[model samples]
Target: MCKILFINNCQLYFIIYISLPTLEKDNEIIDIDPFTVFGLFNKSSMKEINRKSIIKYIADEFNINAKIPTSFNSIPVLNNQNATFYNFIGYRNDSDIDDLWELFSSALDYSKNPTQANRDKVSKFFDRVINQKGNGNSKITMGLYWISPDTFLNLDSRNTWYIYEAGKIPDNIVSILPKVEEKISANKYFDIMKKISEYLKSSASNLKNFKELSFEAWRYSEEINHKEKSKKVQSQRDDKGSGLADEDVDTIHYWIYTPGEGARKWDEFYEKGIMGIGWEKIGDLNQYSTKEEMKKAMKEKINPNGSFMNDALATWQFVYEMKKGDIIFVKKGRTQIIGRGVVVSDYYFDTTLDSEFPNLRNVKWTHKGEWEHPGQAITKTLTDITPFTNYVEKLEALFSEDNDGEIFKEQEIEYPIYDRNKFLEEVYMDEEDYDTLLELVRNKKNVILQGPPGVGKTYAAKRLAYSMMGVKDQTRIMMVQFHQSYSYEDFIEGFRPSITDGGFEIKKGSFYNFCKKAADDIENEYFFIIDEINRGNISKIFGELFMLIENDKRGNSLQLLYSNEKFFVPKNIYIIGMMNTADRSLAFIDYALRRRFAFFEIKPGFKSKGFSIYTKQLNNKKLNSLIECVERLNNVIADDETLGEGFLIGHSYFCNIDEVNDKVLSNIVEYELIPLIKEYWFDEPSKVKEWADYLRSAIK
Candidate 1:
């Protein structure tokens, strides 16, 4: 945390980067004002100072027992009835504090040891908490995170930036936080924290505690905050608005709308895969101003109905609000999921269709197979299941096997790009190198990670996308391997034999598809990662895309030789190419293509603190010695004129210390290490044997 404090008129004024509120000092009150810290917020003025000294000052002045509070209200009462309670946490007054404590404490107790009677109490308590003031809701969440460091990540702009920066949160978690500065309710905050903890535990399973992980998240958030300030200044100069709003990014909404009454028309609906509301008599909703008006009109025309207002609203939504790209699931009497499809067209009234299904929307059916239903039946003809977390997960699972489920066509919604901090935590690379990689990618738009095998080039590429997007959106990322057979026809756009037509058809390649998707959401970033980039004929594969791949040439129209269609690589699409430097058989990338991409050399990360932390957890002397031996071997390899840097073994081979043992080490040495060394010194058999023997001796 950075703070700039200066003395003005003999009064101390503090400008804080991270909040360090105040503590009891010799039974005297010392309170600091609490304000929202934003990514672009800036304060000018100060001297560099130690944060520890500030804490020490408070500690030296007063002595307070360092223990968890016995009761929730004790957090305020024991700390001297100060307004800092409201500043630090969300306690409005004594009465509010008492009321919050009673509810919060009961919920906590129920969570610790829940029973059938109090099973729903946690949800009830969360609802009460969420209904509090927005600022207070956040402040209280921060306090909760502080008390349960093991379970929760703090809810603040800084912490949120960190989580987004890491780009490692699960897809479901990303679904919850779709935009920047999105207000999180109490239940949402808890849900986000739970997911984050689960992710942290999996990624950093070797760690004894999450303290370092939490600090890293905060520190990274601060880093992003600084970057955001710089970006703000640049954006101001560039005359660009702050990208896209949360609503601008299209999302996949799940809906369960039964086709006909009692689902007798389930098979026909499944076959058609269309979503429509049955209120044929209500007429087209575009003519009506409000649901009430429509309902009144419906009453006069149809004469008797039961609970028609709700049905009218559903019809209105089906006609006007249900968007393209929103996913639909047709259900039948809670027994089975009949079909799944995406709404491809806006609602329309088709008199030619069956009278029972006149009000309809076109759907691109992805799956028509029966899937075992997971939840209770939905009665409404058009129900948005996006808000129901449980239902959403179940529906997502039902379509989880679909290979193309993540990517959707153009929609009028916005999505976030990756976060940098999260990328560093996941990839075992130094902060300096990680920051450098990010800069290269930002400036160049296309970056090639070239290094020895096992340097994590491929692993880093996908995560790099996630970190940049700030969301784990697989749809925004596309990966393909380049081989000798890969060609321009395969990469950009080419004519292919049509299976259905029995003739040549113009097929859109992955890159072409990706560019179109990116062009749709020009505000968001998309990633195209190519593995073994040097293995393919770069010149042949890129073709005219070579010109379009350049940053300046982006959006420059060109006529494809095959398709003869106007095409342009979108500005939002970033290219990440991976090349194994040790593969001597492959030629260097074409000079033209090389000039377009920023080349980043990824080295074996043996000296990284993350690797050190990982190895320390193994707590085995032999494992430590093995690392030392590998470092020595790397030095020797680097010194060798014939087998220089490219041939040096990567840390990834030695990173798996979790299952390390004499047998595992021996297998790695004999099979992997020795073979790599032999290839490095193929002309010198004696030298290869010497290094292999020495390597084997270290493992023994």
Candidate 2:
């Protein structure tokens, strides 16, 4: 016997041996059941899939006297035709059927006789299998194994990987078996299967078929992949605390869930404070280790028509993807929102509940009364609508009246007193410059604050609005970031999936809704702030609003493309946009937009009285030394011909630290500052290294 270690770190090995002595020579009785291995692989950790019944159904379809089909898809695996699963298992070919009936009859003959001539003739179809969809193995090979699991082994990639290269590759296999990569001839395949049968018989008097073992091999490969995926989503869970506040709410998944048809289970779920999904016959969703596995079971037992894709996805998300504190918007049909809540418990399978809907999760339903939906919710049973902020906001609006504070407690917007002095003190900007910014917005209806990153551009923009109003009113402010994908449809108004009828409808955009809100309160000021304003196609995003956003065009109406409604930029709406000058990729502002708005430059405030006073209060000697180094570095950046004052480091990087410890300072140098330095002087590696060393030494 020889043991070969394929992966040293994992301690994985594949053993090769000539043969093993029979169990009769040993002291103990042994059991060689592939089904046992298969069960252990999936059933021990999760719910067991009914593999036997499905195998029985498939085997029954290939009986010797079974009628031949016109096309391979005419053969039903779990009563579904043209399923991609058949292609994956290498059972169905998309093409290459010259005479379907004759080929079927020949395959049956080869399975029964197992003669070299029959094998030679039938194996010809192996390469002819269209694209060799999965495993790249002969479909005939898989079929024969299904027909006689004990006498034949599929030898697909899944089976071979488990045996030769996968984690702790199976031990004590007979010699002369095919290599892992070799596509065995029929005789070679028979010899390998016979060896497997012999190895099993040696352990016990009773023998089981290799069908269960084949399933086990597939499970082994599947489990490894599932574990890797589990690791990636671990951060998505807030295992400690109630998943509330900024500490725990790093990422929140917003979901829309429906209680059975017409929300028949709404009362039961609301009363019980539990949400549930059906497909009980497939057993606990936990049994299926992955969504693909759950989807397979759904195809087999529940939705055989293969419409189960979306339902299975929703089921999998409910069981695994969803974490506590994720919002769940509940609705009955298309146009009505029935309730809103936060998921408060991990998923559970309750057999006592309606069997059709056994999978459940506990929910703290904040509101239960009906409210007219602004648009038609998706037709799916469960959907993750986190990406659609407009849709999520509109749905959240319906619950504002009945909101019991459970969901919005953390989001309770604060209207802290903010004015000219407060802004100057915090933003590190002098009163004169701050007043200039305020006047720019007052005169030009639209003003963009452009500066290097971390210059307090966004910060100062917000405070400028508050000072202009003489009070910080979050209700009068709206903020969004512009990306390469931001469009007029997203920024203003365009057709989205209809909320009332599941078709396209003119769903109002954020700016349009904010404008309406501001229009109603004409006496108060409303600020619409766009961060990273130059990242998007300004002309495309502003669309027809370019003219309306002009100081003179306020309240001048224009027909919208989709709704054709006479929409106008409300006079009370003040547009405050921020752009990063250091971003080399930003294009010049749209010429049309440039004419309508005033542009203000914001330099770093490191030398200002406010920043000096603030840093002196901290009294960190190392921080002051670091600031001196940054000031020196900023001089070189400003003097560089390719770069300018826009590329200078901003004071905000040093602003937010409550504790000025060496570790935090070092992190800012190594992780944050060094990366930016490298990009700033990308061609000058020595310059990057010198400054990098200079910055790191100050922290030390």
Candidate 3:
């Protein structure tokens, strides 16, 4: 007899649930009869049928006609009698059966008897399969022969074998499979397909390999389709305004995407959610209300006393025409009461004064059976009343009894103040004896500092600031280099649109800030140092300020459009500019800037005390040798328009200790001096070669 037991926590719920009526001895077990617990009954009782025969019967019912091997071999048993007799007949271990099933399933040939065309077709099928599946969130299910815990794991290994054996799968498909699997596990449906597609299109070889067909299966997954469903929600919203009724006003809140600095303002508006217009966008005057309730709320919150009664009365009339949530501007010079109190309230009549109450002055209040004298009520003003009604009537007109039409408007405006005296006195230099120099600058002070290379035309600008202002701090001096891209906006104020919640708001530029800073500090001298002043789009950079740079127009005030900011260059602010004549490609300095700033030719001053001390340390023989070579080259370059006096080697050359070495000297000859000579003396290579050879010899 064969017995089956169902055990939960070592406690048998049922013993001998089902038994096959067979052998005589109850102790002699023919099979473990694992399925006896299932209690599957057949009407036909076959006393001689083995476990393999029973399995074959079940397989036939399932339409699986594959052959089954006997006697617990590695091959699976298809026939019921054989499976029961050999594998499940007596005391069979479930673990052994599971392992056998896995081995059999893995060994099954999926590509058996496949023709060349069939192989190509499979490859093509998987190509599309991988592409579509890889690009989307989809799952491909391959039927497994078993249902053990390792079924999927076994299936995965089989699938990998099929993909690798196919060999025709694109590299991209193969590469993207692992990533797709990872994405699937993470449940990132949308990004999975996107990432897969990106990998397929990318130059990476892993994605190009089609060996891994799993990516193709994942691309077609249903989850990916769901992820792509709501991609255009925002676009749809933009296409159709808020779905509020035609009669009803819809408040559509939108965020302005400003590129760079505007991002901050856009975020602010998004967070604040349409709290009137951004202050940076508009001027001081602002309005708030879209509906009547909001307006009434504003009136209650803002307006209290019924003063300047006529304007308040007019506002009330305006409110009647306003729709719910409709914003309207309150004209200037409205009733003081409406202005003082942001809202309007109930209306009442006073009968104390009877002299034709249409004028507010004639209106009065009746108190305790006694008439109070009235000209303008203490609570109200004469201006508060209108010609059409008394103070009470005017107050009623201004005050909205019901909260109906309300509007909210933000005024975008900014007032930038520039201090004139403070800027000049602080930024400019002024001492008792040098007061005359400041005066000279006010009238005519044309000063220039000339020096050799490294002698520092650039360095002295800072020193000049110190000499003029007696302040060693370099921050007090403003330094700007002239470049072709440098514009007036960089040197002066210009309208630059900034992104605000409402829209683009124009703001001031750098020059405006600098001038504002200078304007605030006028007690000392301010030095504006322009390095490489000639190499710029001078007219474009200066704009109209080119004319204002003159002495006469120094104090003339100017206003910028975006901001109500007034600016003026003070007389005390001295303009010191440096120009390197060696840069032949640069255009001539702007005549306007030239007139404002003193032109100083900073040539190689070899005779200067600084240069003398710099050269005195050099060996006499080397100094003389260097001088002889420079003189010879100077003569050769004297007539060349491109190679002028600036090309001459300056005394600073001898000051550098490294330049004395033979290798460095040869490099100077080969790299710097030779190239320069070649560019300038193209037709005279012999002369160039001679000069180079002489310099090389002198250095050696």
Steric overlap count per candidate: 16, 7, 112
Every model's TM-score: 0.46, 0.49, 0.35
What lDDT does the true structure give each of the candidates?
0.64, 0.68, 0.39
Q: Rank the candidates by lDDT, best first.
A: 2, 1, 3
lDDT at residue 697 of model 3 (Cα atoms): 81
Which runs in model 1 stand beyond 4 Å of their true positions?
1-339, 342-418
Quantify how close model 1 is to the true structure by its C-alpha RMSD in Å: 24.2
Residue pair clashes in candidate 2:
46-287, 47-287, 149-210, 375-499, 375-500, 376-499, 376-500
Best by lDDT: 2
What tens digits encode model 2's per-residue C-alpha lDDT throughout 1-700? 0111111112211111112112111312122212112211112222233333323333353453544232221111211122111222134443433322233455668768968787666556433432343323433455445445545566655666655666433355633566533445544555676776675566542335566566666555555664445445545442211111122223467898889998899999999899999888787675566778888887867657776778778887887778777899988898888898888887777777666788899998888888887767778889988767678888877766665545344344335566778788878887788888788888897998888888888778777877888766655777788899989988888887765567887777778888988998899899888888888888898788888988888989999988888999888889988888998877476777677778899998987889989898899999998988999999999999999898989988888788888887888788888999899999999999999999988877
Q: In model 2, which regions exceed 4 Å deviation?
A: 1-330, 333-414, 469-472, 496-503
Give one digit per residue, the lDDT tens place, for model 3 in 370-390. Answer: 112212233211122222112
* Best-fitting candidate, scored by TM-score: 2
Per-residue lDDT for 298 in model 3? 38
